[model samples]
Target: MATIAPSPPAALIDGFGRRISYLRLSVTDRCDLRCRYCMGEAMTFLPRSAVLTLEEMAAIADAFVARGVRRIRLTGGEPLVRRGIGELAARIGRHLATGALDELTLTTNATRLAEHAPALAAAGVRRINVSLDSLDPERFRAITRTGDLGQVLAGIAAARAVGMAVKINMVALKGVNEDEVGAMLRWCVAEGHDLTFIETMPLGVVDEDRTDRYLPLDGVRRDLIERFGLVADAHRTGGPARYLRVPGTATRVGFITPLTENFCDGCNRVRLTASGRLYMCLGHDDRVDLRAAWREGGRDALDAAIDEALALKPRAHGFRIEERDAAPAVARHMSATGG
Candidate 1:
């Protein structure tokens, strides 16, 4: 095993008192589907030139890695929608190969993953997280305007075949696909996929009524346990999810209850929009633009923008209804900011 080196101290705080270590970068703001909750009527496309050039992104990433940001996850409306994404993956992987980056991964919708999974794996991406809300064809189409369940399934299989550590992500919306939760879990368990059931957040183009379907994760888990006899706290060691194992199976079910069980205090993430703005939190509005600084202000200016964003990181989201009311515009849409 490679010996892990100690992380050096870094002094940067966003307005919220959280140290920024993980940077989630968006390569494009465009997507193939208009997922009901994420992209509504249409998307306001960012200009081509506005998105960072590969070199520019690598520069910002380099600076962040230098300042203790060791985890990088490339995200987007759907990162694979962007042309030459695999090339970018290779570039980022090569940058990280220098021993600065501790983890590098991608979060994609997986519609185009089957075509790119092999390339991504060859580029050194050992981890992939695919957003797959439903296994039912009709329900999948209903959730994402034009996604093909067959294609998504193929993509997941392709990634696993390529030897990538795969994680299947699902967003649990109450009345819509809540009934199918058991089926999805059963499928994942049989397939040996690390499944995460995330609670629907009140961001993006979510319909107000969708909140009614926002099954608080606790009740969902309770029902599953009552039905399946879940053995609590049986999650794998060092696992991010708090999971429960089925009564007589090796498979485990995991939950990401952002609403009921907020993981904000341990949040080590920062987001970079497709247009190069750095967000300290999903609950923050204004962001520091590193791309603009790289163009006009140079390297020093770029570093300053990172420092500014990090110094403003919130200690905790303090996510409550009142907080949401106060920061009504704080929540950035999931697709554009990367869900």
Candidate 2:
């Protein structure tokens, strides 16, 4: 007979007095689409062995739930690329059903959601976020290097059919898809999906010096009010995005400006890379490797490492133009980091 340790309570408030009830975990770095901003033409990827095993990921999530993390979102370069992901979601859902967790979600490019969303929803996932760069097929292909607009749209339809709360994340690139802001909002409204307009992060290939293609959230919202007569203000979501809405439509818009307005003060989530490294912030390279310690020290050692990483988190990320020189330290690009 085997004995299982008792799980921890389901709630714990962090130092910031924010209830730390949610966690986002990346299962693999493998992705089908290579967006220009996240991954360039040619980039090396981590070896298979370097990536954490499914069991390891579950154990980590279980530990997280034991520590009051009631909500978990499985992220990836494209999480659907990972084999048997539905099975992983099923296991997590089992824990959630047992009162250990309350919510389970997934974020993806929606290329595979049409085929996978039903099973994913059946396995306990209740929400999803799809990344759609642009509505123009040619522009989308150019930006993502692989445009399957029809398939992506079908995927969204499939997920919606399954009663999942759908949100679309569109990164507003200055010269690229900035022109589609209002159009994107209208499209999402027509489709009955929520829209989040993310200001390009100064991470990876996009930075302050690369201003030609960088679209600031403020400028976009200003233009929206002046030109299109749309109005935006903060919403009640306790996450990073400040929500907005079209003046006439039933659509809700959002601005996620990590560069212009640092949300670190309200940051409550932690990121675990595919290779089992914990990053305190998406802007910097500060991380603690739990993979190495896991094999030698077991679960207790891993918990201590996570605690130490959290303790080392800085009050805020004061990133500026000068900091571009050290951008490489911020883990891998968003694709590899499973952002």
Candidate 3:
């Protein structure tokens, strides 16, 4: 019989006294597709040598689990694109069996889920959030820049066929996909998948102006209520989304309004970049270099570094898109910070 280690005491309380229980761990800064809002077309990705090894990433995940982190979400420019991802997932997912981690989820573009869905399911991932901006083939191709819509749609279907719960994450862009959000909602209802609309955040310098692409989710929800008669649903998925269920259907729509409305008061999550840096806030650049800490001593170094990072976690991210051609909140792109 195997022996499970006892869970360690919680040590991730922020200055505001909020307990951090969620971690968005990025396995790679590379992606198969380059979405306009996320990164540039000619992106200069991180060298393979710069990223943390699979073993190191697993160790980091274990450290967080021991420190009262109940949920771990694998994020990325697209995590499925990472090499040996199946092995990495299974390693960290062992926490679920030990009861230290309550849930292990993934956020993906679904472009590679077709080939990796079964492997992910075997690794204890029951749910995934897919980034699907538009239902139209041409529009999707336009949004992703180089993505084939057929491939992604097939991937989503494959994931669902394997009993994986799917949640669609759509970033509301002012003239780009804003008009299609309603249509996407109706399609999500028919497909039996949850939909979430996110405001286009100013994270990095992209092709287009941030102010021009920004679309508030409040207006989107008001429009949704008018057309579909949406009602508030108390469904908590452990992220920063406020949900609303469509009447007479099993589908629930979510809104992630990072700019128009801040969710900092109850922010219970932090991001781990592929390079082993721990970011305390999504909209801020304050981070601790866990790579150096890990190299010096192991989990003890990581725990100490985490304490230093947590103590420095800001009360609120100073995000703003006040005007056109304005610089982003942080110079590092969302891809660098783990989408």
Instruction: Report clashes for each candidate as comma-separated counts.
Output: 13, 1, 0
TM-score of 2: 0.89
> Candidate 1, residues 1-339: lDDT per residue as tens digits?
999997653545556555666788888888888777676656677889788887787777777777877678888889998888888888778756788777778988899999999999887888788888888899899899898999988888899999987778888887888888888878877887767788766665444444456678898899888887888766542223688877666666788876787777667678888888887777667578888888998877877777777777765554443232232234457766765
Best by lDDT: 3
Per-residue lDDT over 1-339 for candidate 2, one digit per residue giving the tens place of the 0 to 100 score: 899998754354544555566677888877888787667666677899899988888887887788877778899888998988988898888886798787898989999999999999999888898999899888888887876888898999999999998989999887788889888877887888888888655555532234555677888878766765666565644458877677777667777888777777787777788899877667767788888768779888877776777666666765553343445435358765656
Better of 1 and 2 by lDDT: 2
The per-residue C-alpha lDDT of model 3 at residue 301 equals: 80
Q: Model 1: what TM-score?
A: 0.88
Runs in model 1 lying further than 4 Å from the true structure:
1-19, 206-208, 232-241, 246-250, 318-331
In the range 1-339, model 3's lDDT, one tens digit per residue, is: 999997665677988999999999999999999899989988998998899999999988888888889999999989999989999989988988989899999999999999999999999999999999998899898999988988988999999998999999999998898889889999999999999999888888888887888888888899999999999899998899999999999899999988889888989999999999999998888899998899898777879999999999999988888887999989998888886
TM-score of predicted structure 3: 0.97
- Candidate 3 wrongly placed segments (more than 4 Å): 1-10
Clashes of 1: 13
TM-score-superior candidate, 1 or 3:
3
